[model samples]
Target: MVSYAAENQLVHLLYARGYAVMRAPRSGRVGLPTPDLVAIRGKKVLVIECKSRKTGFTVEREQLEQLKEWKRRTGGAAYIAWKRTRLGLFLKLADVIKNKGNVGKKFAEEYGIKIKNEE
Candidate 1:
């Protein structure tokens, strides 16, 4: 069971960025390969898988593939949001896919987008 803290934190952050965010209810148990959170601003849509950890995390291959498919079908951007410390870091889904769904801290540091308080 994933904690609500990570998802809620992301929701607030996206809201501050002028995006409307929606979190999946019982996301893990949904059994449908849906993303943890979806945020939209104007014509841009973001499908994100949220992870909160001290170091790194791994997304299942099946989940990664489904996320890719969802992006392809919806024309939305996909990302892995990792909260390692105080703020969340956004990593491109394409990068994760290339790495086989494994996100290490080093990889995140190299590729993660640091979200600022002001966009």
Candidate 2:
């Protein structure tokens, strides 16, 4: 799957969970740090980065740092989701991952909801 497809799936999941979501446009070529999906529930907001995984790959440190900066600046949650797994597994794992005191937890605490993985 492509990155956009993963992002769309994540947006759909967020919407299903009662969060308002928006997708970043693909037509722009500016040097802005556009998040894949932006979701909001109550006072919480999330900036998500979507990834397509095919095994033997994982989130990198630089990307994690970038997400952390985004979360800090926006006071929203930041997450990365792999789009190669079952939706149920994704959400279930998301619950656990989001609870960890890291980027996910920071975002969740700010937004009052969990930041789930897309896959």
Candidate 3:
């Protein structure tokens, strides 16, 4: 499970930038998975799944597929925020994870998204 504090910190960063953000509820009894954060600014919508790199970037297949489906259906960009890094990494999930165990650095680097936070 992703840490609430990490997700909260990421959401706070977006909120500081005047972006509207909401935390998606966990999928337990609901049986439906949702992105970790839903951020909106103007016409930009970010379906972000927040994770802490301290434990490595990990995402569920169902969540990833749902995010992709959301993009296809809603036209919003989906990203996996790899938190707790040197400057944090916002990886735009290109597609569903193939025959892999985890979403590794090489795969994330392919997105070419390097968001530097103002320290």
- Which candidate leads the pack in lDDT? 1
TM-score winner: 1
lDDT tens digits, residue span 43-78, model 3: 888898777766455577777888887777658898
Q: Comparing candidate 2 with candidate 3, which one achieves the higher TM-score?
A: 3
Per residue, candidate 2 scores C-alpha lDDT tens digits across 2-119 of 4666667677878988899988664662766666667899999887766565442344555556667777788886666545444311222244244442333334234333345543
TM-score of decoy 2: 0.61
In model 1, pairs of residues that clash are none
Best-first order by TM-score:
1, 3, 2
- How many backbone clashes does every candidate have? 0, 2, 0
For lDDT, candidate 1 versus 3, the one ahead is 1
The 10-residue segment of model 2 with minimum total lDDT is 87-96
Clashes in model 2: which pairs? 44-111, 77-107
After superposition, candidate 3 runs with Cα above 4 Å error: 27-29, 55-58, 95-101, 109-112
Quote the RMSD, in angstroms, for model 3.
2.9
